[model samples]
Target: MYCRNCGNEVSEKAIMCVACGTPPLAGNRYCPNCKAETSPDAGICIRCGVGLINTSNHSEFDWLTTLLLCLFLGTFGIHRFYTKSIGIGIVQLLTLGGCGLWTLIDFIMIVVGNFRDGNGKVVVNKQRA
Candidate 1:
């Protein structure tokens, strides 16, 4: 592997670059796979032809689908299904009307990315702002 901060060779599993005292993969100045210089905005390393990982700090959420489901079928746990909360959705449906308040609260939380899927992974919304 290579140190992204200084383009120096480093251990593949190294968490920090000893030469530059920086996290190995914390920068976009070089390719981790080939140690070749790369453009800051480049997605693939030209020398190794390997895709670079973009570690952007952003949570993935499905806004449109969640909003629609919450507005249209929130009473029946459709939004829960859309968000992959099948057990909660089924319980909401089976309870007849016990989950209405819970589902409404879930709608708000989903819009804000507080609600996650069953795997506890945030849903990645691909819509551009």
Candidate 2:
């Protein structure tokens, strides 16, 4: 593998670039597969034609924060709001917290990874990853 940030060769399991100290897959400057220079906005590598994968592993969703919101402010759908699902949040709020049942279900969903963020990526345990 190669560091997309600096075109430096990197181990497949390396999360950050040793050369640049950035997440190995965070940048769009070079193709991860071919190490060919590329446009930042390019969807596919010109040389390898492989779809570039984002390297940054940051999650937009905060599991602990979401759980707290669901437990304390669930009636107002504050957790949904935090996750950028404003429409669902509004529905939960208007429904009097989905009669409380919806809130409970949402909590369970979050715990089991059924719930996703705006970016459609699963929330992970950062320490474990």
Candidate 3:
């Protein structure tokens, strides 16, 4: 493997690049698989055909806020609205949260930290992360 920042060869499991003093995959100047130079915003490494997604990062939505909203105003789909799930929020609002069954299920999902935002990102507490 190679450091994406400096193109310095690195152990596959290494955390940071010794040559550049940065996370091995944190930069976009080079490809980690083939050491080929890459455009900053390129999603794939051209030479190696490898994806460039940073696997170390997982962006999660707030769990507490979603949980509380679901507990208190789920019947009105307030939690859904807060998560930017506008279409589902409107449906829930019109249907009164599926006559409360949907609200109950959503509350349970939130309590179990299994809820997702409109963007499909998982909702989890920062401490848990």
Q: Candidate 3: worst 10 consecutive residues by lDDT?
A: 53-62
User: Judged by TM-score relative to the true structure, which candidate is superior, 1 or 3?
Assistant: 3
Question: Against the true structure, what is each candidate's TM-score?
Answer: 0.47, 0.61, 0.57
Q: What is the lDDT of residue 108 in candidate 2?
A: 87
Give the local distance difference test score of model 3: 0.82
Candidate 1 vs candidate 2: which has greater TM-score? 2
Which candidate gets the maximum TM-score versus the true structure? 2
Ranking by TM-score: 2, 3, 1
> Where does model 1 exceed 4 Å of error?
1-61, 96-99, 124-129
RMSD of 2: 4.6
- Where model 3 places Cα greater than 4 Å from the true spot, the runs are 1-60
How far out, in Å, is residue 66 in model 2?
0.6
Q: How would you encode candidate 2's per-residue C-alpha lDDT over 47-120 as one tens digit per residue?
A: 98999745343345778888888899988898888888888899999996799999999888877766765555
Give lDDT tens digits, candidate 1, residues 1-68.
88877989998778788999877876779988888898866779999899876432223436677768
Residue pair clashes in candidate 1? 60-123, 60-124, 61-125
